[model samples]
Target: MNRKTLVLPAVVGLLAPVLAACGGSDSGSSGGDAIVVGTTDTFTQLKTRPAPLDPAYAYDVGTWNVLRQTVQTLMAYPKGDGAPQPDAAQSCGFTDSGNERYACTLRKDLKFSDGTPVTADDVKFSMERALTIKDPEGVFALLSTIDTIETKGDRQVIFHLKTADATFPFKLSTPVAGILNPKDYEKDKLREGFSIDASGPYTLKAEVKDKSMVKAVFTKNPNYKGLLDVKNDKVELESFPSADAMGEALSKGDIDVMARAMTPDQIDKLSAKTNGDINLVEMPGLEIRYLGFNTEADSVKNKAVRQAMAQVINRGQLVSEVYGTQAEPLYSMVAATVTGHSNAFLNKYGDPSVSKAKTRLTEAGITTPVKLTMHYTTDHYGAATKKEFEVLQKQLNASGLFDVSIKGYRWQEDDYKTKEQKGQFDVYGMGWFPDFPDADNYISPFLDKDNTLNTPYVSNKIRNQLLPQSRREADRLSAAKDLTEIQDIVAEDVPLLPLWQGKQYIAARDDITGSEWAINSSSTLQLWELGRGVKG
Candidate 1:
């Protein structure tokens, strides 16, 4: 799946007061009434394609947050440990020892929000359309392993893979594998506009948009048949321009919950609150931030130059200065929480040292003060990104071995399509929210020949040998040796620099139930779990 990027209009000022007046009371209704959710995430539109709520085109976490409520995947992760469980399917498992042939039997009488019956054919159509359309900004790459999709009558669906892949089930659980109604969505093109017709806990009642989505209203789908027992009857997801605005909206009771994009300082202040009106829910997050290199670029093409820069950079100081306690230093492409993670970068480079960086560059017969340009998005990640990049510039320039300059661009309009996707920057900062909570999800998307980053990272050993071997193991933990070696290779090559891993935070009213269980490990929000608590 594509990395999570936020794109909201500057209408927070206009939204807060109006929403506050119309907001519901803190008490629960017997039928479970509507609750408003606040976020800095908004609907993103590509220059060439339609707004990305369609299953075939949607990729990022923001789109998935809404899609997860409206579209049902065959398999899905439950509230507890991150494991794929049957959602639309009554049962699913691999039919072969090679982990190549997977099969699923659809639940009896599953219907879409529009009252159309869901069949194995719908599942096949959904997967086929995503691969066929192959939107450049979409998550088609995640489904590339499927060689063929076969439907056995109306109930059974089978997936034949090109190679052994234990992570296939986990991928199917993501929104990229969200099943679609063939009658509603065209097979060869992305469905235009914000309308949705799928079988999930909720259906899109209305969407307010001006250039970008300002609000989306969702209502419980009475025809929906799935694993989720949706708690609320209705929900409204409101978008804000900044984290401060999102927090302000939550503080003033304009929104019952603040889902994402809150600053560290805001979180700290909220945590220190002695009042019983608000609750801060913290969960283990799989989100990570890193700096990627364009191996074809003149400034950082040389492996030695990338290695030198890596040696001089300080991850501890970066997280401490910019994120405070909101994030921790990261060392591997695979997050520290994932099994088989290694501190390969730290083990190789040790702590940040200018002398070591200087020696590495001098030994390579390179000139002093290497000119480097770093690129970052202005609006996507959060407000702290600017300060983070500033700290990075100061760190690199302080070494006296490199001269760094930073540039910012709007994520959807320019940076993603024209700059980063085309590999125009020598060095660029990006964040990764894993498609699934697995080590392979973290590694393969960035290291493969045709990676998500659009950088020139063609590793013969990783792409051809190590990754294939790891996927063959049915027991995921058994692939640790290969995974560790891959991290070692990444540390030596330095195609990307690991920076910090983030924790998920959700601030909600004290009366809001299931606030702690709202988001799963993959960073997809489970809006079905959110509801108002009963009064004493």
Candidate 2:
């Protein structure tokens, strides 16, 4: 996904000592600098390596964090702003009027980390592999508009489209479009042997532990010829079992940076220090935490019951009292930063009145004591999730309109065994970080017939008609008109309720320079950017 402009200059926040001398010094002069970054996010491990190391076979942000640094795509997000720029390509842009045909010229003398030449055939092979393999979590669906790929010379590659898609440029900048070495991977099989031929800033330094890579090391890629100035000699990424463990590591100086899954209380405690120790990079976030309703469930089948539940939930209290300033109450599934977003729930529900909720239930012939069972993951999201869901239970039960029963599940086992709940639950919690910044990514994934929600939501207009029409429109703002209607439809139907939009926070040790530019559009950290700060 493309992102908004970044504001992480060398400004001294809580961590004054690290960034205090960043005004005039050359960034690359210092050598042999290294840093350790801790992450609490869950990773999908395959065959001992980070599952996402292969661009054609991986998904999830944890994998994205590693891939974004190790793999180079045709285009990439610039550090200052999340705008797209040529990465392996000398230049790339749309070549035709129908908003379909896109072309790129590969950079001359480009080579993999192993010194093998990068050619147009490699690019074609990578794209073809991703499309043919059809990894369920892969980027195949995102590139559905591509009709054909044609290579002209050794340097030029052209993509013909079946429909007009202005967002195709943004698509190329994603990890899915990462060019691969054809010699290492086959057309339909995922690459094995823990071997990698990197084309980006850093290369994996060791063979990852088989079937589990909770910790890994990386070094600068000597073969890299890209835009980023590599400031650090090495980077070590360590994953923890919980946010508290990660936070404690940062406090004890065991880790130089803490990336994702730091709780709100952890952030507050770090922010409270007057000493110049911890610096928190407040990243612009589009991640949404929402509640999905299973309309097939007898308890919530009625539209009135769903609408009443939406009306009674207090968003402001959820954000302020539970998440602190780290989150904002969301009114639409499409976040505030995106075009075509509106406060549809706010316009319909107003400020969470119990009396209004009661009236809504009464109209649907529901009694005062409506029964509901809510399910959420126990450890996957963060430590604060239990508290957040507890608050939600209290708010609903306080109205005297519901008898809510809450259930917890481990994330890995929850989806596979969902048939126990008859393919639906009364309500369930889920979090979404964008794959691409387009509003379509937010809606299309959740509401389609075989949606991730597992609900039998069959919206023919949204799936078969409206979304297809919007995708064909060349202008994004103009296409938003169709998307706006989709949001309104979703709000009225009330299958999902927008709970909150998160703010990305990275708590790093004060002595880490270039930490300001670590986070990319994918909300994943770039470890290559971290270096030891100049000491006073």
Candidate 3:
């Protein structure tokens, strides 16, 4: 696939029990109580609180899970509407035939919480500053392509892109392109931290370290010129360390929501009692979890060997047994929701027979006993993940073709990517969450050689023409046509193998209404925007 199409800028944590459901609430009001959505993470910092929190630097889905209401973009998806609608900007679109020139005019009365003007210069500053920041991760690297930006006056700003970037406008619609106060970001030198200065309806009202975190109160910023689709009176986010803690808190009526991925026993216990205390809504997620074969791994380097390893496991059984039908078998690189998903690998190998594995290994003339370590972040997904890996080890070892070993690391601890990058494992389980709604978000990050996940992934063909060619295309949907082909090629080469397509599931208290999220959140818990039966 056009690997770049799937560029995931958000941290993209797996499933978090959200206060929201698949369809986000249009008029955000949960039943009687003050909407106090619960989350499982605490942030390291919020130094430059976003005026309209920008998603370019750090777009934690968990955080947005709470912060979305307080923050908005130039455009937004009002539930059931696939395309974006106006929010902050009075009107915004492309004026030039070539799609190189874009313009947005403010609603005139817009101001930040601090009562500063949300002018064209502020918008320019946000984009430029995000680019200048040291996000070596290149999450904001897309801004590098901008040719020039100028304010067409006080209320109107025009963007003349370097190329005909059709998606540039849509890019602006994302949180990354949200407007920010030049003063806050400027003083911080565009550095990321915890004291947020948001212009959204809510703000980070309070804070504590990791133990027990609380959010103050949310008040409408007078300068807020309506832009985002969500409308909520007030809300607060509460943080818990583990699911157990979240459940205990929920039972005590201390918190209002929990995102999915509970222990099978936890789901069973919660499911059995018909207290109407929780609601679980499942929707097709914009994420996929896969087994990445570090090309640098000698065992994985051999095409035949990689093919044999890929053919041994039954993805269907893994999904059914491991995820308990919570997830779907993902044979394609891009998730199903992504526009152009193709079963290229499945078409080539077909149903994964033991005979096929042996045949592939036999044909390869592989004499060396192939052995490799599989790695995964322990804290992120759930208990099933470990079981999934163990089952994998059993399946591969049973084939008599591989001496598989399993290793695990706590994601909360620092070894998350470091140990994996050190090549301590031949294969590791990883997931991709979309940065935006486009299919391009799926392919870009993992396949790009310089990206975090691609450390062991090196394919010149996919990297060069196929990838760069797709990226140059201004039409994202059309670009998916190219990306679909690339995903198939990458599958054939076995640098990374698709495993499962996840469905987003968040558990919330029944009375707590008006919480829903159909979008992909890369995983940060934000606590502002929620209201308990309160709306302005």
Candidate 4:
């Protein structure tokens, strides 16, 4: 799923003082009170597809945050760093030596939000429907490894893969593998409306919508029998019109917590202890921002044009001038914190040079002052997105070899369908929040034949040879060589340019507990970990 951009302090030392000052041990076992959490992330309901809450159609962070509470997957991520633990399954493992065939045994007497029993047939049905429907905006691409799913009796489910894929277990830990009740969902179509029937810690009580989702209400599920402990009785997720509105809701005592939508200025003020009643918590994030070029567009179709643009843009100046201390320049599509990261882009392009950029364009016999259009989402990311694009336009126009125009569109209403999916722009900005914490997750989705970018980037070496070799290795770290080669190939092809990576931050009133644990490493909100506590 893609994430909305949020900024945090780049230096880790700056958070030490703030963490020490806001010290109180929260066991997530406090007062069972209802809390209102506010964010700027909104949802859209399309006429041709199902609602955003359906597991088959949701591919954004905002909708998955809600689904994490209502839909249970076979395996789940622990609070920090570790292997995935069983949630709905009692035991699961690869049955073959080649990591191709996997099997799981369901826990005895598991029930959904309704009183229906959860069987192995329902698990098989849920996965098959997602792959069969193949929603254009969905995460079915993550399930491309499975060749078949088989159910044995009523308690066991087995998966047969086309090839050896070591990352299949991690994929099952994501929300895309969420098990659905067979009776509530169609066999080959997305379930309409916002209602869901699943076995998780919380249930969807109600939703408020106005063209897009405005608010959602979640309560404790009576029939939920899972491995997680539910700490809160109820939670109200409210979507504010803007970042300022969300921050004001926290200040006015209307909302108990503010998650992932604060502007850089707001974050700075909070970090300086301007608000005595609020506390800020920072977590390590794997979020990244990059620019994708339309390979078929007339202006950027030539590989030399994309390579020249990559060489001319200055990442250091962009981060310092616009983002202040909130972000760091990224040199690889795989984030620096990941296992197999390298400075492939930095090694290829070095520092920004206008002379080198001009020489590359001239050698290709391309015309001077190349015309291109750059597009970005106006409302989805944050207020700084507009300024970010403005700085990009200034830099490109100053290079004297390119003519650039910048445009902004609202994400839900205009940008997603009309602009991005249709490839209406020469170059566009996009953000990625990883589906799982793996280097393969970073490389495959953008460069594969059927990619999420909606642009064709056909790299036969990457899709056929390198990717297959990497997936066959059981130890993921041993596949670093193949992953490094993939990054170097991307640097040469220049299908996308890596820009900056961000850290995660959350702010809440003093009475609210578990703000630190609400969002996991994969950026999914675990609402069951939140509760109200005594005021300091």
Candidate 5:
């Protein structure tokens, strides 16, 4: 059940490319008892009320970030790079061959922050409650494969899957699988409070508000019985309205570290200014930005047209001209750092070629000046998004195969609007931050019949068959071949075009130690790894 030695090392090995510059020193040192971390307004709420400490009801990055610190899961990603070892559970694995049945034995003497014992029954309640509530965007869909759950006495729990699933462990490692204090939460509702009743490395002390920002204060949790070495006595997370504001605060010594939501421009400026003022930790990226085609739209229905667009679009140009080294051109839906990643699009289309694009249109019997409209949320993605799309429009238009017009939408509408509402735009921009570190997470969410992309893409070979088969293989490396094939299918179908993979960066005061080690593949920071420096 303890597959840490074998499973994690393999996962880390596959991710070694991304972690190349991730290892090394702390950001200097300012001997202080408290550290203030500034980020975007992504961490404003503690919970949305009846289901207190329920991971199923919270889905945003902010909520997940806080929940990850307060609640323990069956398995968890370690400080640096390793497999998800046992956290709340002493050991866990499948009991049967099809990878259909899962079992976990609880760690002895587990307790919630309120002093209640965390037992197998609580684990069962936590998972089953998430499914029962069935919050459409919540963790329930992620756990939909679980057909039944059973608790054997006080220490053991079993999960009966509706079908074979190999990536179940990765699910167990997510915030969705975070265990709850059964006494503090109802089985079916959102819980409202600033209360900290769960068990993790930190305990919530208070929530403070300043203008548009919210600051969450935390102290080390005495009830936490995990393997992590908690380095700081107090951790304060300050949320801001904009990345620009956050950057200014970091420069003015208003905060100790800034983690998320800084623009590439901001990163460049901060990197250039790296001295005693601040230090930047460049972490590997699992995040991807891409172009999604609404195949249902009349303009993009022709496969040749899509292929032509692919041929003319220049990823290298986008990375250099727009994103700099903060991002790299991506040819596969699966990121380069993950196992089973293949550069299918690059192999098929090569570099940008106007002649190739024109030939594809002529072969398909499509007319000249195809007239394509691209859509992107002007407010959702960072400041670089508009420039990125504008550059794309120029590239496609310059090829003379088609006429491209660009449109913009607010973040709320762009995200929530159905294909019918946004029909005016044939091709649109999209981005994804992983729910887990697996390649399957990248493909399954966009290619399956009921895909998250909101575009109509029903691949029987992929959704109804291949992906399910891939999920049944317990060995991830063995499953890599199936995933690679899935990526090829995506390239051929062209529902979504892979654009670029991001580079994670953290800017912290020069005196902070442990800052370099905080960013991980989950795209979440390990606050416990950070400590105060020698000079405040």
Candidate 6:
């Protein structure tokens, strides 16, 4: 459980509008060595771990980002861009009726690494199996908007949609939508298998449990043909136990690059020590830190109670002292880089005002000395979290109006997210990195009644139908306008409070290049494009 959202120092200016990118990576020069990448994702039990490295359960973005390189999809992204373009498919489109229809034509020369030809059945099986899984990590959830999956001839896949959603293709470009082999689970039961059954750039070599994970050399499929959004033929990943630990490793020249978070102290040290051969690259992150109030809790159920509590929150003090000055103030439910973000809450509430908060509480006929519990994840967000919430406790308690208790989880485990998503605690903090680069990513997860994020949120008009409708619109820019309206409603409702956004900090050895992050609203990193220079 964490309370504040992480905002970046650089993206306060770039969070608006859209930028079109060519859908795939341009070819880059190849090198002799495997590029070791570092990250702090050791805890989350990859639901799809060691399972053919398929996309059926690539629910977590970090997990999916890894799978994307190992498994090729029907289409890939444009160079330096985020939108999709055809690759394996000659072209795909909906039926003129616009309902009960979608079709795709497969590339002429395409085969899985196993030499099995890529066909329409593969696509159909990949999707149908997901829908059959009752709950498939989130693949089904993405395509749940779909009504039916059908195939025409040996090369065409038909998707019958439940609604005229324009974002389906964008959703398809996701790794969760990656195609898989039918024979792996051809028996109808999704039994686990560790063999390579993909048509990707690289194949899995080994998975080290909880400590490190490494991918073998990537090789172009001699007969392999599929869409790609990257330039490199083969890539490798070496995972570290934690970001802080990874930073130490990168500095020791143990790894080629660092592609994850860093301790605030490590970042400060890296910023000052240029001659040490480490490069510290900073970018706006899609993850935000925020405190969610369990609106269903009697003490917090009332709008006045929630509002009163929010007003006394001293965001500025917390960022400076606890975050090591690595944060900024946030006023929107969505982060700065996300589309449709607005400072509606700032406009309405101004700053932390104990007097005003107390007045509201009194006027509502409620007393202070309220008891509250806040949940946080100890491992995922780093050491700054405990202090972050402690700062929150100090602010709320000093108002002479509330009593606060804090709880913690060990990253994705502690099942803290489930509790927070289920709306179990009085108040909890979470750091959300977007699933994709749309503003809908912010509003959709938190506001969707089905998403379990409405935990502290009761079913409301805007969240129920309006947000979904916005997501259905094909035009993301237009959808952004609708999502902004939903943001205002959420901020006014106080279902969740906006806190701060995070910046991505990577501490890489100077020889590594192309670790540049996508300015995506989701802040996705294209690890496939990174390479190592000859050892200097």
Q: Against the true structure, what is each candidate's TM-score?
A: 0.93, 0.88, 0.82, 0.94, 0.87, 0.84
What value does the lDDT take at residue 351 in candidate 3? 85
Q: Encode model 6's per-residue lDDT on 1-536: one tens digit a residue.
A: 10112332222444322111111122234555666776665423434333424456445556565666566666666533455667667787666454346677888766777888888888878777766763423445666678888788778887888766665666677765667767665524443433346776666655554523443334544555655444445555565656667777776777766665567777777656535455565644567888777777886888887888768887778788776556777888677665567787777788889989889889988877787787888766676788788888888999998888888886544556556655677777877676655666666566564453546475467755776677566555666667767777776678788788766655556555454442234546566556555322
**In each prediction, how many residue pairs overlap at the backbone (N, C-alpha, C within less than 3 A)?**
0, 2, 60, 0, 20, 33
Model 1 misses residue 314 by how many Å?
0.8
Predicted candidate 5 versus true structure: per-residue lDDT over 477-533, tens digit per residue: 888778878888877878889999987777777557777666665557788878766
**Winner by TM-score:** 4
The candidate with the higher TM-score, 2 or 3, is 2
**lDDT tens digits by residue: candidate 4, 1-536:** 11222222211122211231253346455346678899888876766544677787788778788888899988876654346778899988999999999999999998888879999998998888889988777488888889999999988999999889998888888777999988888878877777878998788865656556677788888887767878888998888989999998898999988886789888778777733768887666778889998898889999999999899999999988777777889999998777778899999999999999999999999998999889999887788888998898899999999899998888777745346767787799988888887888888888765567767778899999999899998787788899999999989999999999876777877777777767754566777777887676
lDDT of 3 by residue, 85-184 (tens): 6666888888977777888887777777788767787788777776666353345654544777889777888888765665565566556566776666
Report the Cα lDDT for residue 18, model 5.
23
The regions of model 2 sitting more than 4 angstroms off are 1-30, 44-53, 191-196, 205-210, 366-368, 413-426, 448-455, 473-475
Pick the winner on lDDT between candidates 1 and 5: 1
Write down the lDDT that model 2 would get: 0.74
Error of 1 at 280 (Å): 0.5
Q: For model 1, where is the 10-residue window of minimal lDDT? A: 10-19
lDDT of each: 0.80, 0.74, 0.61, 0.80, 0.74, 0.63
Q: How many Å off is the CA of 520 in candidate 2?
A: 3.9
RMSD of each: 6.8, 4.7, 6.4, 4.0, 4.8, 6.0
